[model samples]
Target: MSRPLGIIIAVSLVFLVGILQGAMASTKTTVIAEKLAFPWSMAALPEGGFVVTLRGGQLIYVAPNGSKQPIELSLPDLYATAQAGLFEVLLAPDFASTRELVLSYACGSEAANNTCVVKGNLSAQAPYSVINTQNIFTALPKKAGAAHFGARMAWLADDTLLIALGDGFVHREQAQQLDNHLGKIVRIHRDGSTPDDNPYKHSQASQIFSYGHRNVQGLIYDEQRDAIWQHEHGPKGGDELNKIVAGGNYGWPIATYGIDYTGAKVSPFNQLPGVKAPLYTWTPSLAPAGLALYNGDLLVSHLVGRRLQRFRYSHDSWTLTDEYLSELGQRIRAVYTSPDNEVYVLTDSAEGQLIKVELP
Candidate 1:
């Protein structure tokens, strides 16, 4: 072949590869359900549907055909304030046979509210109302106001559950304290009992797994890596994603990359000797919410950023490889993968929607 002809062919191939890469990253989003009132979190059911939570204090069962029914729940302490309300719904690992599920929500009046988790059985009939409901856990030192209720749940392979709690906005310093549950992730058995092997099992705060977090809204147990990954909201500009370590301090206010809402520095130092650094941080705040690890990729749902981010991690480094569905122009609240690996996202809005994401 002529030298000039070879050069032209190589350039054309490069341009073709670039076009294919761009096409592969593009996504198609199908709206599964719309006009929802602030849908927060959801989990796919083994029986062909989803159990979803709404920030307005409702539990909904959505069928495969997109039909929706409100699941009747009985909880007198259920609180629905600003950022506090029904937060997450998760089906048990044995849900196929047990019909059991768990819910995370806010409890108590506006004067003193805190995050809470409850376990219950769903009725066998239509509507599938929650039955035999029991309060399994509640975050301590319930504070006033409704700004930050970091209430997300993930279950380990051993069936133990991990619950993330927020710093209560006004009590950010307590996240550094070990005596309380604020800004901490706690591990407990299915029955709400603390596991004996937990790092703080023998201490006063027996269930505490890790501490020093702001408002963590995303939690996932990555089966591939056998690690718990989480992300939390920062004050102004410092959203963070971390690989949660047992008994580790995450350094909320004392060592933050974010500034106060008033633009004051949150801390003079960004890292402390005892506290662990974030695996990844987002500047100007993504306000990251839901997280899912699928096909070796970390998918994050962003609220203020109004997009979905996909990250690939390798050799202790995380790379933001793609951003999807930004044109939807909606605040994404949560993301989950179906059994077949299809990704679904929930929008945070009065006219909220559940969207299925498809990639080329």
Candidate 2:
């Protein structure tokens, strides 16, 4: 967990008004745990506090008093290297009653690995433990290398799950193919069964709901509007924020505004006949990491840009209304807006932090 550039610092244990000049109305960030080991995602526990994932296969509980306690768990050997490691943790819709949750992580060897989802029940106390864990679903055609697992998960209104899978960096072309699970968003029941109403129910990759995504780090289900919004990382430029539609083609390597990392062309066109265009795009690559809605406003966190941007959808478009936490100079990994609209962010680094932003 070496930080090449170094970690970003900010005012700790203090509250400030109007943290930014150009935009934000009133926002403040309070650093909770300042020494996390490269965490990926978080979810608020129904009882209290949070359950966070450390890339090296550790599930820890963060208390309301800002204390950190590592929870012991029995997990299979994980492909925890580079960008491949433990990812998103999502509590079930009936978490309060069942104490069950879903977690997405990379599983397998260096030469062959794929994204996997597991269901686990949690204990009620401080020395927390995950019990009776079961593998629910796994992405098909395991890929080589360690980049781009895109393991973000969200539960829809009907209690089905949506898992985002990335286009393995070298297998970008497979994004347009439907026979494999790479570069697609799939829908499944809690028990790992493909939903009968899935977009490709009869295809080889029967669980697929949408295809043509790069590495989707941010995903959310807007229950109010019954919509799914996701953001993915692009090559050099062409990062996108898209409103997902069922069975839609998002046009990745097939049609993109971004060129290759080597500056070669990825495609001849940026738009295709049957491909869906982005609701909004970030040129020069903002490196978006998470997405959530705070009081009906969309909040996107970034790694390269080191900021939290707020957008409001009105009049048929999403507009940037404000930005926060950029002055801290940290790579914001995940920003989760709780059910009550409370904001939480995880900075990316070996000595990163879990901070709560008080938004008014």
Candidate that scores best on lDDT: 1
The top-ranked prediction according to TM-score is: 1
Per-residue lDDT over 85-183 for candidate 1, one digit per residue giving the tens place of the 0 to 100 score: 899888899987888999999999989889999999988767679999999998887789897888999999999999999999999999988888889
Estimate candidate 2's alpha-carbon lDDT, on a 0 to 1 scale: 0.88
lDDT of 1: 0.89
Quantify all predictions' global Cα lDDT against the true fold: 0.89, 0.88
Q: Please give the distance, in angstroms, between residue 143's alpha carbon in candidate 1 and its true position after superposition.
A: 1.3
TM-score of each: 0.94, 0.93
- Worst lDDT run of 10 residues, candidate 2, spans 8-17
Tens-digit lDDT string for candidate 2 (1-360) = 345423322232122333344376657878878788988899888667889998878888999887999887776858898998899899999998898989999999899998999999988777899898999988989879998899999999989999999988899888889999899999999999988899889899999999999989888998877889999999999999999989999998898988898999999889999999988889899999999988888999999999999989986568886888878899999999876678999999999799999876
- Model 1: lDDT of residue 65: 79
The TM-score, computed over Cα atoms with residue i paired to residue i, of candidate 2 is 0.93
